[model samples]
Target: MPGAREELIAHITEKAVFHGDFILTSGKQASFYVDLRRVSLDHRVAPLIGQVMLDLIAGVPGVSAVGGLTMGADPIAAAILHQGAARGVPLDAFVVRKEPKDHGRGRQVEGPDVAGRRVIVVEDTSTTGGSPLKAIAALEKVGAEIAAVAVVVDRATGAREVIEAAGYPYLAALDLADLGLEA
Candidate 1:
């Protein structure tokens, strides 16, 4: 049997990859698209994603929480939180809204307080890296030390370069090649 990461890759390739013309969040055109939500939200695949992503961010030290921009990172963070607990890792999850709420404490970052804690920003897939960077900005305001930026699928666009150029370590569990696709 394949290991968790390999199994997760198989699931993504079989279920999430779509061919033909597509437009990405980055406003770029592509011949293929990786819709990780298709599998990331699946019952069976969620745990696999949790396991694979846990392994992906394992090396980053002092990580107390995982999260990113709300919509895409929501399920991914939940997966990691559950899987990390199952493995005795004791991880927490947070959410970064696109804008601070006008009501109810007027806060942007939600969940347990991340102040003075280390966090790894996560996303379902990365194209231009805007989502993670936006999350990072909010996290920083709340005093969360960003250990790294991680993604389940990297489209091999300029995201890595953009994140790394901004001085955060960029970690990706799978790339286009792993899904038998190309940039």
Candidate 2:
């Protein structure tokens, strides 16, 4: 896992992270940014994300499914779902849209039905836990038992407290310190 950690950190540092002044999705300003999608969608690196994430969540006891908010969570969920299959473990994937689709079934939760399932929300990076927390709220509305919350990179903001305050364990594959960008 150390190797995986090192490799991902290097890949992210070289390809995804930017050291500069910018505003984040959460309306917060930062000296750096981590655009994990740069690496999350890559054919080669996606599996590494999946494997490392899957390894972290493997012992959660009853995770029948994994997913999170859209855009960012899309690839992470897909990769983990696929990687889980390759590892002889079947796990479903779901997405929590910004709002329920205006047409069709008009469901906010997409993909497999998550009702009564043990779900772990996933994300590419967590700043304030806003997006994943939104996903958790949506999933809870549908009766999905959130086993935990997982992130590829945790900026070590208040996300840990925010997520745990919502009553679920927060799991991070990497953190600001891990990326050598400790706050």
Model 2 spans > 4 angstroms off:
none
Model 1, 66-132: lDDT tens digits are 9999899999999999999999999999999999999989999999999999999999988899999
- Estimated TM-score per prediction? 0.98, 0.95
- Local distance difference test, candidate 1: 0.93
Provide C-alpha RMSD values for all models, in order: 0.8, 1.5
Q: Model 2 residue 14 lDDT?
A: 86
How many clashing pairs per prediction, in order? 0, 0
Give the Å error, residue 55, model 2: 0.8
**Candidate 2 residue lDDT tens string, 44-132:** 78988998899899889988999999989999999999999999999999999999989998899998999999999999988888998
Weakest ten-residue segment in model 2 by summed lDDT: 1-10
Where's the lowest-lDDT run of ten residues in candidate 1?
A: 174-183
